[model samples]
Every structure is written in structure tokens, then in C-alpha cells.
Target: MDFLENVVSKERTLNPEERVGEALRQAGVSITITSITDVFAFAIGATTRVPVLRSFCIYTTAGIFIVYVLTLIFMVPILSLDERRRDSGREGCLCLRLPADYKKNRCSQKLLLEVIFRRIFGPLLVKTPVKVVVVLLTMGLLGLNCWGLSGLKNDFDRTWFFNPGYQRDFVSAVQDLFPESGYRADFYLGNTDYFREKEALEELFNRLSALPGIKNGSIEFWHHSFLEYLKEKKGKPIRIMNVSTKAMQLTLTRRPPPMWICKQADILLNSVPPVGAMNHPGKISPGLQYMCANG
Candidate 1:
């Protein structure tokens, strides 16, 4: 309005409506489509592993929508005051091409975009056989992609963040030497009274035993073996040193060495007690040696 009134046509001034129409005819649609492409790029990039792009996309989308709505509402009036003669017979002139003779078949950017985006998809949507084939191909591709994704396992190797060969080889060597390997889970009892809450603990143990992915014989509780030992002790007195040990000593060097010294020697040597006819609890005591104290 300012240009037309002051500079271009001082005598015959152009109205606001005429100016808006002229602006739209010149570059509005092209600008709108370019903005749409930008928004699409932002949206798709947001879906990928890019946080800054996602934030920019969100702000850009909101800003674009707000300005677009405000412009449409305020500037695009229904009534027209100017009578500018249009050459093209097209109704919705959103292609944003320059006004020219419609008879010429010369291709423009707008026509090329229309042909690729609209005309190409239009036949695929309307035609039955093409639509069916496209849908089947799409479904097959989706399924194959899902299957491939399912095969991707989560890898958290420490070497991934460090120098690959050196750190990885060092770890592998350590594992090979002192190969301490086991699956263990710890449960904090806090200040709970274990004797008073035996039933709850038993229930918890049963639940843990029933859990999936737990090896059949892997679950171990201190109380389980302790209770079994108590049960066996209650049945009969457990012989600390059997007659065979004394007999073997008599056969070799008699005099019957002190029981305390014998026990210390046996423990230091990690002596495996022979399985006798009497099912003694001493045989199972080695497995009961745990790092965590039940009390």
C-alpha cells in the first residue's frame, strides 16, 4: 500500500485487498510450500536421534501455525476492490507461477511438484489393483522391518565407550584368569525381624523360586540349609569325629591327637569327609559357608 500510494502509482492508489492478492499471486503459495517442507524436515528429524532439531521443529511449527492463522484471518479479506486481468484460467492459483499464456506447455517448478506429489499418488490411490499391490508391498516391508528390529539385542559392552582392542582384551584376559562367574540377587531386609517374619520370608522365597529365568537349583537362602541342619541335629546327635578317623589314626600313629587340633587340621586342609552309612550334616556344611551372615 505504501509503495503503490507513494512511489509506484501516486495518482491511482492500490487498496489493501489488491495488495494482498498481488502478494499471494507473486510468492505466497511458494513460500507456504517451502515452509511446509521445512516443517516436515523438522518433524522427521525430531523422530530421529536429534534433540536440538526436535526442539527447533516444535518451536518452528508453533510459530508458523500462529503467524499463518493470524495472516489468513487479518489480511485475506473476502471482498475484492481491484480488477486485475488474470491470463490463466486456473481457479485456485496456489502453484505460485508467474502469470503467463496458459497455452504454452513449458514445465515449471510448480507443475513438476504437482506431477510428482499429487498426480503420481492420485493414480495409486484411485486405481484398485495398484492400490492393492502397493498396500501388500507396504505391509511386507513393515513386517520385515519389525522382524529385523526384533533381532537387534541391547549391547552395553564397556569397550564400546573406551578404546576397543586394548580394554576389551584386558577384560577378556581377567575373565579367563580368575573367572569368578555367577548370577546373584540381593534383597535388603532392613530392620525387619527375620524370626518373627519367617512366614513372609518363606513366601518371598517361594515366589522367587517360581520366577521365570531363575535357574532351577540356583536360588539359595541361608535359612534353608540352617533349618535342614537343625532338623538333622534334632533327630540324632552328630558325631564331631567319627570312629573311622580315630581308627585311621590308631593304625598310623596312635596316642589319639586332640580333637581341637584335628578339627583345625581338617578345616585347613579342606578335607572332604567320606560319605558314610549315617547321613551326617557335616558333608553339607561346606556349601553353607556364605559371605552374607543371616543373623
Candidate 2:
């Protein structure tokens, strides 16, 4: 306003009508949208330009609404599949155990009978075809979840993912760097910062490496080889191990030793907390299904 007023006042000789037109030009609208790709491109472009439109604010808003509505529309079937999956979970989390540990289970005999009846025949025999449809749909969804979803389901809900892809990619990257023979587990010497003593890595690696099947699965040093590379290039050889002390996050990784080797190494590096006063990043492991506790 000040700039326009200054220019308008610049000429007392100019007509008032002409000054009004000059001020109008200065306050004129602006628009920019050049890269239009497909049908989506044209829709974005044609609606954006308007007479005396400052920025096509309403069109932008409507565009956003359109996107939201489309997402919800496409997502409806996915949600229905999800509900079916929930119905299916009753079958999945439901384990048809042989009551072998029935004595240890909290449920009494009557309660156990009720559970079996509820889980098995309740849906299978009694429910209508629609419910059966839900069962089949759920089975299909779960199959997709396990086989197709990869870690994508976690993006939808964390609980759905078995383990984050961070673990998968990290493991794969490590495997690529240091080949895992064929073992399913790896030994980790993790602490805060994870690379406590650069040399300690070789110790644990060599120690765990001696284990037979573990040789097939690679041992990923949270720090060793990287340190050697770093130090060999005159970079950092050793740095303080930054253990996440507040939370006992025992950060470690190891290719699982053969079942036999694991039986032996439990003395040194099983799930037991290491002697360090500080806690390590705990409660997480690549193979969450296994009993190997710490790294």
C-alpha cells in the first residue's frame, strides 16, 4: 500500500482516475502451475486459472477435498477386507493346541471345553454363509498380509507388522557386506552408540564366529568393520559406546548359532543382561520369535 501510495503521490499532475487504474494494476492477482502431466494434470491446470483470481484458493481447496474423497472411496474395500481380517484373527491368534499343557493353563476343564467349542464349531458349523465369507475373506487378507504386505501393513498399523523393515533392510545390508553362511540368527555386541570398544567387536565376532551354523549366517558388528574402514582411512578408530542407559535397550545382532552352538554360548551372550551397569537397548531383536535374549 505504501509503495502504491508513493507512486500515486509521485505525480500531483496526474489525474485521480489514472492513479486509481495504476493502483489496481499493482494489486493484480498472480497464478503459477506449469507442469501438467496427465488427466490429473489437466484437471489441476484448467480449474486453477480464473478471472481476477488471486490464487484460485477455492479450487485448491476443492482439489484437496477431491483427493480426500477418492482416497476414502478406494480405501472402503481395504477397510472391509480389514474387518474381515479381524474376524479372521479369531482363527489366527486362535491356536488349536492339543490341551497338552491343559494342567498349566488357567482355564478349568469346563472353560477349556467352552473355548474349544467357541473357537472351532461356533464359526465353522453354526455361523451363516456371510460369516463364513468373512472367514474366507479374512484368510485371504491374512495371506496377503503375510505374503504380500511385507512391512506395508505396519505403515497402516504398527501392531500389524511382525518387525519393522528397518531390521530387514539393515540385516540385508549387513548380509551383503558380510555374507551370512545360511544361519537364521546373528550375534550382536550392542551398547549405546553400539560400538563400545572397536576391538571388542573382533573378540565377540571371532568368538561367535567359532560357532558352526552361525558362520553361515553373518555376524553384523554394530561397529567393527566400519570402524576399521574409518580408522584405516585415519578416521575414528574407537568412540564411546552410547548405551541407551535409561531404557535397557541391549542393542546387539548375531546370526543364530546352530542349535548346538547356541546351547554352548548361552553362558556368555544369551538373553542375560551384560555386566555393564548401564542398560542396553532391550526388548528388541531381529528374530523376535526366538529365545536368544540380548544381541
Candidate 3:
């Protein structure tokens, strides 16, 4: 639209081809700069870790690039054709030849808004008093925006991205019913010797549980179930006790020493069972055995 306006504003003495060439010469730098700026700005979004945002950015960047290319390739010829149509006194789209008087009158007349801006508003805006007022108002807005930034809370609501469907309704219902449990963060432990670092792992879990906004008994580590199984089988209370070398050997061999351990392993591998009736089932538990096996 801006490119077409630039072409149309060229001297009436110039032909359509000359006007197009002149418009490109005058507006090319600005067009290129703005398009490049927008492309780079959206390209930055591609670096985000969120899959949806990253994909959006990637597609938007490509789209902007393609549109920019198309504009350069096609707009000049289209603008030249429109300019010829205007010069021939033909109505746009309809291609009807307009009356000579009407064409002349239209060509000579200026738009009321353009006239008002040029003669009144534009001149008034340049005056010292109005300029000072404008600067003050702009600064006031800037200050308010900066103050508002301090109160901005960073949050992600997955429901906002969902369309109107069963998935969206289900998520909305869950969020309404259990606001605290709606959003969660998963922590992964990799390549650690759980037998040796059991205490450290427990301390880490306890600290995570103690953090503000973490629901009580919400932390689920498969090691907890393994500990329970050991306590029951060995007929003793257990807290941070490293398993015996024989038990460790059994674990390494995938035998687990007992049918009960195998049953517990199946449960651990499938999902992290709830700690108690009050707690929600842990959805993020990748079993210790799975992690160790992969690592």
C-alpha cells in the first residue's frame, strides 16, 4: 500500500514506468530496512525453548521473507499497470472510462483529512508549546509503562493456546478445580549412581518439597517406592540406607533378588503412584531403572 502510494505521488509528467522506477529509488532503502528489521525480530523467537512459540517464529520469519521477495518481484509491475489505468481516466477495478470533467475534478482535488493535517495539525504540532506538551505527555506514558513493568507477573497458561475442544475444556476444568496442581515443573537426574548418592538425592528432593508454592507430598521420586519395597522385604525401618552389595548386584543383573521387587519395578516403570490418598498421582516420574538403563 505504501509503495503504491509512493508510485502514485510521483510527478504527473512522468510515465508509469518512470514513476515506478522513481518510487523504487525513493522507497527501496526504507522498505528493505523495515522488512529486514521485522524478519530478524521474528527470527529471534525461533530460539525459544517452547515448541509452539519456536514453530510460530520459524514460520513467521519464512513468511515475512517470502512476502518481501514477492513484493519486490511483483509490486512494481502491478503499480505500473494501476498508474497507466489512472492516467487513462479509467476507474480502478471496474475499468470504466470516467467522464473528462469528473476525472479532472478528482485529479485537482485534495482529500479533506490530508488538507487539514498539512495546513492545520502538522503546523500546530511543530510549534514550541505543542512540542513541549507532546514531549511531556510521551515521557509521562514512558514512566507509567516502566512502573507497570514492576507489577507484571510472569505466568504460562496452556489453556490460552488451546482451541475450543474437549482438551481445552478438560484443562480449564482441572485448573479451576486444582489451581496449584495445574502447572508443574519436572526435574531430571541423569547418570547418577543412586546407590551412592541416595542421601544427596533425598536432600535435593526434600529441598524441592520445602520450596514455596510446592504442594505437600507432591514430589515423586521412584527411589521412594524402592525404599518402601526394601523396608518391607528386609523387615526393618529404612531412611537413607544404601542397599547391600548383594542387592546392588541383583539390581544390576535385572533379577532384583525377589518376585516382589519385580512387581515393584513394574509399578515404578509405569507411573509414580500417589504417596497418599490426598496427594495427586505423580505424572512426571521417569523410573530410576529406565534412566540408568538409557544412561
Candidate 4:
């Protein structure tokens, strides 16, 4: 659109090819700058961790590249062809020949915005008083923006991602009723020797429990339950040595362990109970799902 406007706004004395070339030259810098900025912005967005936002950015970046290529390779030649048709006194889409006097009758006219900017705003902007007022207004706006930034707070509402429906309404109602309700955070450990690192893991649990803003009595480490189970089974104090034989037996087994044995093994060697499970009182068992280790 800008290219077409530029071509039309050029001097009527120029030929079709000259008008097209001049328009391309005039519009190239602005178009290139805008396309580069847009592509760069979306490229940064593509690196975001959020799945929806990353996908959106990736598709939009591809679209911008495609459109930029089409503008140069396709739009320019089409505009040149249209300009040629106009110059030869042919109708715009149909190419029907018009009267020979049509070219002479048609006069090049300035756009309304171009006329206003050249006649009124251009001269007014140069006057000393007008320049002073413009500077003062710009400074005032800058100060006001800074003042607004000081009061701005960052917040995210999960409901913002959902459309207006029963689900969104329910979530908004819950948030309004329980503004202090906690959300879940999951942590995973890989290739850990839970038997050797028991003290380290216990210290980690204690540190998590000591953190401010954590709800009291919400930390649920599976080791705590396993310890109690062992105390009940052996009628002795909970210690890693008591389970050494069972751990060895499981490790030396040729066949896969039973489901209950697998669950116990997962709790002993791999799992840590979720920290904030108490927040969801209605949930019967809110912990990591245990999977059996393959033999």
C-alpha cells in the first residue's frame, strides 16, 4: 500500500518504470527497518518457555519472513505492471483501452494528509513559540509516563488464558474467594543415591520447611513414611542399615518386583512427597505417581 501511494504521489511526467523504481527506492528503507524490527521481536519471543507463546512467536516470525519476501518479489512487479496499464490508458483490472484523451484528462493530485502537513503543520512547527510548546508538551508527557511507571505492579491471573466459559468462571470465583490459596511447584531428582544422601535430602527438606511464606506442616517427604513403616515392621529405631538386606535383595532380583514392592522401592530410593499437597484438601492422595523400575 505504501509503495502504491508512493508511485501515485510521484511527478506525473515520469514513465511507468521510472515511477516504480523511484517508489521502490523511496519506500525500501522504511520497509526494511520495520520488517527487521518485527522479525527480531518475534524471534526473541520464540525462545520463551511458555508453550503457547513460543508456538505463536514461531508461526508469526515465519509469517513475517514470508510477507517480507512476497512484498519484494511479488508486490513490486505487480505494482509495476499496474502502473504500466494505467500509463497506457487501460482500465485497471480488465486492461480495456480507454479514450486517447484519458491520460491528458487525468491530473496528478496531492493526498489530503500531504497537503495539510505541507501547508499547515510544516510551517507552524518551524515557529519559535510552536517549537517551545512542542518541547514543553513532550517533556510533560515523559514526566507523566515515569510517574505512571512507579505505580505499576506486575501480576498474572491464570484465568486470563481461558475463554469466557464455565471453567473460567469457576476459576475466577475460586480466586476471589481464596485469594491466598497456594499453587503447586514440582521438583525432580535424577540418578540420585537416596540411601547415601539421606542426610542431605533431610537437610533440604528442613531448609524448605524453614523458608518464609511456606504453610506450616505442609512438607511431606516420603522418607518420613518409610521410616515409620520400618519402625513398625522391626520394632526398632529407623535406620538405613535395617533396609540394607531388602535393598540388596531387590537389586539382585532376576524377575521384576511385585507392585507393592515396587511402590516401596520407589518411595525409598526415588520419591519425595509433594510439599504443598495439604492445600488441596479434597484430593485423597496428592503425590508423585510411582513407576516400577525395569529389571
Candidate 5:
């Protein structure tokens, strides 16, 4: 053939397979695009199969649908008008004069993508049994979700997110080691009038302590209201005490100066931990110390 390569000593015609491969390569048909698509399809398939990722896939697909709908609503008319103009031999932009060669190059890949999408979703959406099964399953799940939501509580138990293995082991260890004594819940109240409202505050504390979940006599308020404490003193001036805005501070500790647990408007209360199983510190990880300190 005229396309045969010439060597110094001899001339050899290229193999048919080699010639075809070369032509395909020059036309930009190569493994790179196919490999990318294969990998992407595998990843999407794998992700869609996972329970957690399936929701994300569904949401992303819905978002894509929304974008497509928006594009159709806003862009189809403009595109149709442009096509009409082009057919009528009217050009708006100089860039339109050049044929979009990239479209030709991507024809095979476009066809492949179209085929893959149709194969993936067409039968499931079109077939009677498949569609029925999908609808029934979706309705069943939706009903289950509604039933579950009906029992949802206002309080969130952060322990639900703890590692299962760690939680099981920790409960076993705690049950083995300290079956008699468990952790307690500490509640803090700020902006309290401890001294002036001692009776009311103490009543609230007693009521809280009496709750079946709270340990008996474990409830203790560290800060007594200054106004209330002063009123009890035998010789305290009634007028001065009534006029004064400050409360006396008392520290109860091992050192000479005990840490006053209360200031003018703040109060600290320490009590038995709430008796809920979820209140167990073992259920919380990484932030156990922070929860204990702040919660």
C-alpha cells in the first residue's frame, strides 16, 4: 500500500490491526476516557448500594433533576430560537461560525453514557412489578419513619452515636466493677436569688430531688443566698439588710479560703446523676470530660 513505511533496506506494509489502532488513536478513541467512565460507574454503583450513601445519592439525583427542570424551563426556548435563527441563515455570534468539533469527538462516549443511564433506571421505572415493588417498599419505609417519629422525645441522647463495641465493653466493665454506685447528674442554675428566694429555691430543689430518678438526699446546693443568710443572723440590722444589694459569701473546703460556690446572681447545685441508662458517661466518647464539666 502507498501508506507502507520505508526502511533503508526494505519496505514493510503496516499490519491491518496496527493501522486500525493508529487511526482510532488519531481520532482520540483511547482507554483513558473509557477507564475514567468505568471507574466512575463502579464508584457510583458501589456508593448507591450502601445504606447511608444511598440517601445522599437519592438527594443528589433529585437535585440534578431540579437543575434539569430549571434548565428546561429557562433555556429551552432560547435554544429553540437560536436553532431557528441558525436554520434561517442568521448568525448572532462569530463563534457560531466554527463547527463544534468536540461534539464529533465525544459522540461515542455520549452514546455510551445514554445507554448506561437508560439500562440502570429504565426497567426499574417502566416495568410493572418493579415499579410496584419500589412503590410498596417506599411506602412501607415512610410509614415506619412516621411511626418512629411519633415516639421522638424532646431531649437528645448523645450516647446513640457512641461506638457499639466500646459501649458494650464499657457497660460490662462498669457492671462488674461498680454495681452499687453510679455516676450522678449535676445541674447548675445561674441568675438565682438564693438569699432572697431561699425557700422557693430549696422547695424546687427538694421537688427535683424527690423525682424517682434522683438519688435520695444526694441533692445539695453549694450556694446559699446572701440576703436569706443575713436575715437569719440574730443581730443583723433589718433596714441595712433590706437596703443592701450584696450577699455574704461562705466557702466550705479544706483550705483556709473555701471556694464560694455562689456570687450575687449565680448558684451551683450538685446532685445525684439522673437514673437514665443513657446518662452513663461510658456512652459518650471523646467529649466525656467536657460533658461532665459543662452538662
Candidate 6:
């Protein structure tokens, strides 16, 4: 082992791991090379069995499949950047960013491959070009996947969640009657006696909500987005309004509807504390719940 290490370690520019890899070549035996994508794919695929791994399956089959694929289209640039770095013969950004003494910097992908071969040694297959080709092919396949995703029949109608059957039909009929009136906002009104009385809360909540980026506000002339007020409303009457964007049936045809001007969006109620109960809106954080309940 020292003989091999001594042979490889003599290379001035090659990283230590790269040196070890060269030593392995002298010894013979190859292993398969893994790329960033392979790492991610395995990382994602493994998540199915290991619940912890699933945290990385960002590419879920949600809402619009085609759009999701299109979104993953961004992976192309990232992979390309990796390829460019590998070809330039410079250490990766990670290596450069690390403090000079970081061992991992010297243990580059190539060097690591060699070291593995020296230990378990089989001829290490899959080189830089192969990895790049694999990544490009995968991205292309993913792009084509967008077509199938786009074909998915998604009911993006605004009325469905709250009003189900007749509400859907009513919304459909309304669309026929006035295609321009498709936009709607939902305000989950929590009946708190506070807003009507707390002048400061009312004024602050109202003024900010009217501001852009804020979907809803509590009081008129106050600038508070509906989300901002969510934490503040603690057991108080809260009004959360959901705003609609242009993607609705017709952009200009719809406008933000005042409560009286339009039928308000549905009311979501939280009858219990946010954790543990079936009626709770948020999932129970078992870890936090344990610490809080027992501690």
C-alpha cells in the first residue's frame, strides 16, 4: 500500500486522491464513475426506502407535470457548469472555496475513483465524457417528459376545493355567463372580537395587506399581507384573503373583488391548536410536540 501511495503521491499538480487513482491504474482494476446527476438520482430513488432520503425528491408530480419538467430544465445549466469545470482541469469551486487544508479538496472525483480502484480494484469505468453525455441525455429525456406532463388533465378551477359539486357547476355557469368574472379571493374569517376594538392592530393589519406581495390585510388603510397577520392573530378573528394572478381565465377581465362586490373565497377554520388534533391544520411535529409536552 505504501509502495502505491509513494508512486502516486509524487505527482506535483494532481491532487492526492488523483495520485492514488493513478497508483490504482498501475495496480489494475476498474470501478464505475458516478456524476452529480447519478448522485442525485440515487439520492432521490433511495428516499423511497429511506424516509430521510425523500427530502430531496423536489421533482414531484404536482400541479402541471409539463411545467415541472420545464422547471427541471434549469438543471441543464447546472450540469453544464459542472462539465465546464471538470474540463478546465481546475479544482472545483468547492475545492477552491475550502480552506487550503481541507482534505476533501485534494480528494477530487478523479482521485477518489483511483483510490477506490486501488483498494477494491477493478478497472474504473465511466470517465468525464461519459458522465457529461449521461447528464445531457438525462436532461433531454426529462425535457421530453414535459410533453407527457403537459398532457395531464388538471382542473385548475378556483371553485372546486370549497364548493365541490354545485359550486363547481355554478362557477362553470358563471364562466359561461361572464367569462371576465373568473377571478375570486378567499377570506378565512376568524370571528375575533379583537379587530373591531384593537385600533392599532386593525390599522396596522389593514394598511399593509393592501400593499402588493401581500395577498390580504386585516383593516382598511393598513398595510399588512394576509400571511404576515397569520402569526399575530393568535386566537383572534383573522381574515386571510387569497389573491388571483393573471393566469386565471382572463387577466384584465377580473379584478380584486371587495367582499360585497364578489362572493368571497371559502373559509378555512382552525378549531383546535395547530398541532396533534385531527382538526389541526398543521401536521403534528412529533419531535417538537414531545419536547414541549414532556419537557
lDDT score at residue 47, model 1, on the 0-100 scale: 64
In order, the Cα lDDT scores of the candidates are 0.48, 0.43, 0.67, 0.64, 0.45, 0.40
- 111: Cα error in model 2, Å: 36
Instruction: Give per-residue CA lDDT, model 6, range 1-295, as digits (tens).
Output: 4434455447557644455456556643322122334445654564463343354444432323444344346543454454445435556656344444545534343556656887554433356776787799999999999988999894444443445677788767866796643343323223432222334434544443444533332222211322233334344554432212222112112332233122222212233222211121111111110111011
Candidate 2 stretches with Cα past 4 Å from truth are 1-181, 187-201, 235-295
Cand. 2 Cα-lDDT: 0.43
Candidate 1 per-residue C-alpha lDDT over 1-295 given as tens digits, one digit per residue, 9 for 90 to 100: 3332232244235554565566566566776887777777766665643445567777877777777776567645532322232222333345344545545454532456557767788766888898898899999999999999999995433334456687778766755674543223445443443344445655666666665644565655543443344446458643322224423323223332333233332212122223112111121112111122222
Off by over 4 Å in 3: 1-10, 96-108, 157-295
Q: What would the TM-scores of all predictions be?
A: 0.29, 0.19, 0.57, 0.62, 0.32, 0.23
TM-score, cand. 4 vs. native: 0.62
lDDT of 5: 0.45
Q: Per-residue lDDT tens digits of candidate 2, residues 1-295?
A: 4334554558545454454446435543320122112334445554533422324544655566565556446643443443344333322244333333333334432456557878986768665886788889999999987886566642221223336577666655654685533325444334433333434545655666565434323454433443344345455454424323322224222332233243333223334344444224321112222223232
Candidates, ranked, lDDT = 3, 4, 1, 5, 2, 6
Q: Per-residue error at 199 for model 4, in Å? A: 14
How high is the lDDT of residue 216 in model 2? Answer: 27
RMSD of 4: 9.2
**lDDT value, residue 241 of candidate 4:** 53
Residues 149-245 of candidate 5 have per-residue lDDT tens digits of: 9999865333444577888677657656965544445455544543455456556665665555555555444432333344455355444334322
Task: List ranges where model 5 is wrong by over 4 Å.
Answer: 1-103, 106-109, 117-176, 191-193, 222-295
Q: Which stretches of candidate 1 lie over 4 Å from their true place?
A: 1-112, 118-182, 210-212, 236-295
Which regions in candidate 4 have their CA more than 4 angstroms from the true location? 1-18, 103-110, 164-181, 185-295
List, residue by residue over 101-212, the lDDT tens digit for candidate 4: 6544233553677789999999999999999999999999999999999999966566678999998999778667865654433444454555556566556666756656
